[model samples]
Target: MFHLLLVIIYLAFISLGLPDGLLGAAWPSMYQEFQVPVSYAGIISMIIAGGTIVSSLQSDRLTLRFGPGRVTAVSVAMTAAALFGFSVTRSFLPLCFWAVPYGLGAGSVDAALNNYVALHYASRHMSWLHCMWGVGASAGPYIMGYVLSGGGIWNTGYRCIGLLQIALTAILFLSLPLWRDRPGNGRDSATRQEEGGGAGDPAPAVPLSLMQIIAIPGAREVMVTFFCYCALEQTAGLWAASYLALHEGVSTEAAAFFASLFFIGITAGRAASGFLTLRFNDTQMIRLGLALILAGILIFFLPLGGNAALAGLIIIGLGCAPVYPCVIHSTPALFGADRSQAIIGVQMASAYVGTCLMPPLFGLLANHISISLFPFYLFVILVLMFLMHERLLKKTRR
Candidate 1:
């Protein structure tokens, strides 16, 4: 059972990362295929956010009524089908239609898995679960780039990813015998006070209500910090490769290598963080992660050229490395276990705003100015995040 759980987790994390890496790698190709403006491209990139936001309205009740495994498997299936449909569509309208279902799948899996994990597993496992997402996300681009480079059609790359999603769904289906609907004690919900879980204990739960979750003791700050953190992470991710290609004049393959470095760095950092959190306070780690990200974004935007800038991107990746897992792991700990899912739902939905906001903002900026100006946007957001971090959950950290 334990080994099977590890396999499911590894596969699930790969699904999380698939879209993350694919978006950046496929951005240029999508632009060329759709012949859309950068603004539209940015909007398209974030359309899933809108879908996830809407579906979050029902995630809790849905999970409560149906078991997490069933919900998770169904959602993963939806995401896979959506991605498959998205890969084949020649028109934008149908593509938009597909985004809605994809978002629903995204929202559902997000809520179900986090809640199930927190309710059943250790806090440290929560870190590992999300880190799996980073790993999958990091690897996705390479896979996409490989297909494209090997003379495969662009849509074929997406289909390959869809197949990967199907594989993950299959694992969940096959593992149903082992997954518990009600998390065993000290595992998922055990740490929640209402569930006989202790307060202030580490473990993430599925977020329930967006409106209500934000009202919790330190949730607002976590959201704000997450907003800042996501904006920086997403912006750097979605646009950095374009900056390298369009501005630096690197080839598509070379540019992907650069972006892969960032994701790879993130994956490496997340993997280490899962282990690190077992012995440390997450807040302290968050602070350190934020500082590293701040410096990395600054380095990415600096006037330097050649190997120095490349090194800067690596540094930036290292900086961003721990911030996400640290913040995500902090959710259930901050909100308590039972309400953790609700709070995380709110956090994830609200968190999408960052993903939605920056890509378009960067797109608009890029349309008006140089891609060099692109890094400036993230750099500015990084500063705000740095300043905002202290304000985020200020009272709670004390």
Candidate 2:
């Protein structure tokens, strides 16, 4: 029963990650079809981020009332509806508008699922669960690049995705009955009490006075480190394709495929990290990851080096792959598993801020400068993340 439930959750997470890959593939078509610029294409990311922020903020309440499985169904349904909306969008404004609900749905699912898995599942499974997301994300775009047929009639493409989402959502909903029922599994103590629970369960500790969580040796570093890591990552995944398509003379289909390369790297890296955790501590893995990312980001921009740069992007993918999920798996141990969601939720909300800021910032940057220059910002963001991670880990050890 446990293994079956774990597999279902894994599949659900993979489905959730599919949009990351698929969205990039659709960008060029939307631009050509709508007669919009690359900057406008970037707005789609902002809109999605905005939706994530709203849903994340509300996630505690939703999970409190309906349980993770129910919330998961609603979020997945919202994602399907939004994907369908993207398919049928008549104009740019309509498409931009749909992102709100899409983000809401995605954010809800992200918070609920991460929290549920953390509170209930083992640390090892946490890495694998997110790996599923990476696998799904990698598949979403590669399929589109092959199947999109010159990026015309994007509806045909998106409708297929919508069908996929609907199918995935149905599976998730049917499996909803399998998720365990528990109150405050991932929230802070007070929040848990409001949701109803007894003292008998091995509750995650919470302080009565400060209201904010105190860090364990390594957790604070992990949280802040991930905040920067995810922010940088979300920026790259969401904007890299638009940057290429808008300015690099790459077709949307091709640019989307390039974007998928990053996720593919991430998928491989994350899946590897799932097992690697058995062999390495978070700090050692992170240091190695940071080194690769630094090298990879530079190689990605090397002059007269397309193939090398592509290889670098893959390395970047491998480097970026583990940090977020590693931090996630580690968070529960750092913060009591019970309060893992609320603490991580706050950190993830910060990540949403990065997602919100980067798209429009890059969009406006691309408006004035060039899309090539836009990626420079991501590079800088990554360096900052690495430094922050180093600092956070130092703090953790003490």
Candidate 3:
């Protein structure tokens, strides 16, 4: 039963990742069809991000009312619907309308699943689940690329992915029973407090309110850590292809394919990290990741051309691999399992906000100054993330 739940959670993470890379890959064709400026993509992105933020903030309420399994199933259904909408939309305005549900679904699933794994599973599974996410995210662009190569319309790509999402949603509905049969599923409820663990522990029977969660020692720092880390990760990903083509003089097709190495690195690195967990604690793993991220940025800035940039992106991917899962897995240890659901929800929102704001802001700067500054931008974000995480560790210890 536990293994079955793990399989569902892993598949859920893959679904979470599927849409994330779709827009970027399909936008070149989509904008052409809609007769809109390529920059118009940001509007849809912001709308989705806004919706995600709203839903993520309310995840605890939804999870409390419906349970994680139902929340995940419903969220995936919403996203699947939105993706279908994207496939059928003939113009930009309809696409904007659909993005609302897309973002909301993404956020709810992200918050619900992360908190569930943090509570019920071992730390290694967190890294492996995120690795599964990387697989889906990486597969998205490949699916679109295949469609484009076969002379299919951009909508065909969206349609294919949407259909895949629908199938997963059906599977989710069928698997809802697995969650109910799991142990300790109701432990966080006040009604279950007497049967739950000891009193006065960090994870109380009653969940913390948002304000109360933030009032905990290191809460603000962890929020900052999430924001900075996501900002660094997303910025590197969104800009790497452009940075390579424009800055390193790589061919567009080659750059696009090579740019995927960032995610590939993340996927491979997480598999490696799961093994490394045998020797390293969470803090040690994070510190090692930060060091690799810094090294990757430095390599990225070197004038050695496209090959160096590819190597840098891969190294950065390796660095990013462990940071997210490790920080998330530590939430229960940092505060308590009682507060984890709320904390993880807010963390998802904060991370999405970074993903929403930073990439575009960097684009503005990249437009004004040159794509060459991509490495510099990532370097600054990496430094801030490293410092904030260290502070979080210190505060949690004290």
Candidate 4:
């Protein structure tokens, strides 16, 4: 049953990634057809991220009320609806309107599933489940690329993916029973305890109010760590191609293609990280990831050969791969399992906010100063993330 559940979660993650990659792939065609400036995409993205933030923060409440299975079902359905709306829309305004549900749906599922896996599954599963997400993220662009290559409209790509999401939503709804059932045990919390050789009941620590959860020690620090790390990750991802093209003198097309290595590295690295968890704990894994990220950033800034920038981006992706999964997996252990849901919800919200805000902020700085400073911005965020995570760990341990 656990394995089955994992499979469903993996599929859900792929659905999440499908829409995510679509926008970037379709935006060029979209802007041309809609007669909007490329910068207008930012407004749609910000609206989506805003919706994600709102939904992620409220994920705990929704999951508690509807259960993860139903929430997952409904969320994906909402996203599918939003995508279908995008498929037929003629103007930028309608796209922005649909993005609200798109982001909301994605955020809720992300928070709920991360918390669920952290509580019920092993650390290795956390690593691998995220790898599945990487696969989905990569697949989205390919789907869009295929559509564009075949002379199909961007709306066709959106519609096809929306249909896929609808299919996944049906599966999720059917699998609702699996989420409700605990194999060979008591309730979900009891199952968690039994699987871990009795960590004791975690019921009391869960279902916390927002204020009460924030009052817990290390909560704010954890949120800050998420914000910084996500900022670093998204900023690097959004700008790596431009940075390579501008600074390393790489061709624009080559730079765009090479930037994908960051995500590929992340996916492949997670496959390896699942094995590493056997030898290292979550905290050690995160620290190692941070070290690698710092090294990658340093490589980015170095005056190496033409291929150096590509290598740096790949390395950064690899470094980023483990940190997110490890940090999420540690939530049940760092805070009580009872509070894991609430904490994870808020953490997801912070992550979205960072993802939404930092990339634009960096773009603004690049507009004013130099795009060459991208590496430096990432370095500062990485350093701050490390410090914040360490501080949070200390408080948790105390």
Clashes of each: 25, 2, 1, 1
- Per-residue lDDT of candidate 2, residues 1-398 (tens digit): 65787787887888787777566677777688789887686678878887787777666556655667778888989999998998888788999888888888988899888887767766557778878887777677766776676644667666776788898789877876576634544454433443455667445343221134433444455445656676667667767777666755567887778777887788778788778878886656777777888888787576744446556667878998767766665566655655565656655666778666665677677778776875577678777777777666566442
User: Model 3: runs farther than 4 Å from truth?
Assistant: 180-186, 190-209, 248-254, 301-306
For residue 349, model 4's alpha carbon misses the true position, in angstroms, by: 0.7
> Against the correct fold, how does model 1 do in TM-score?
0.80
Which runs of model 1 end up more than 4 angstroms from their true locations?
A: 23-40, 87-90, 119-124, 181-209, 241-256, 297-306, 363-376
Question: Which residue pairs in model 2 clash with each other?
Answer: 51-103, 217-396
Worst 10 residues of 3 by lDDT: 188-197
Candidate 1, which ten residues in sequence have the lowest lDDT sum? 186-195
lDDT of 2: 0.71
| Alpha carbon lDDT at 208, candidate 2 | 22
Tens-place lDDT digits, model 1, residues 1-398 = 76677668667766966875576677777766777765565465567888887666566656555556677788898999998997898866787788888888888788667766755565567667777887676577778899989988668888999998998889888876666535443234422322333556665444345567666666776667767777877777777788878876677787778877886787677677777777776677777776776676666556676455666677777777777666666665555555655656666676688877877788887888767786678777777776666666665553
Q: Per-candidate TM vs. native?
A: 0.80, 0.77, 0.90, 0.92
Against the true structure, whose TM-score is highest?
4
Indicate the residue-level lDDT of 385 in model 4: 95
Candidate lDDT (C-alpha), each: 0.71, 0.71, 0.86, 0.86
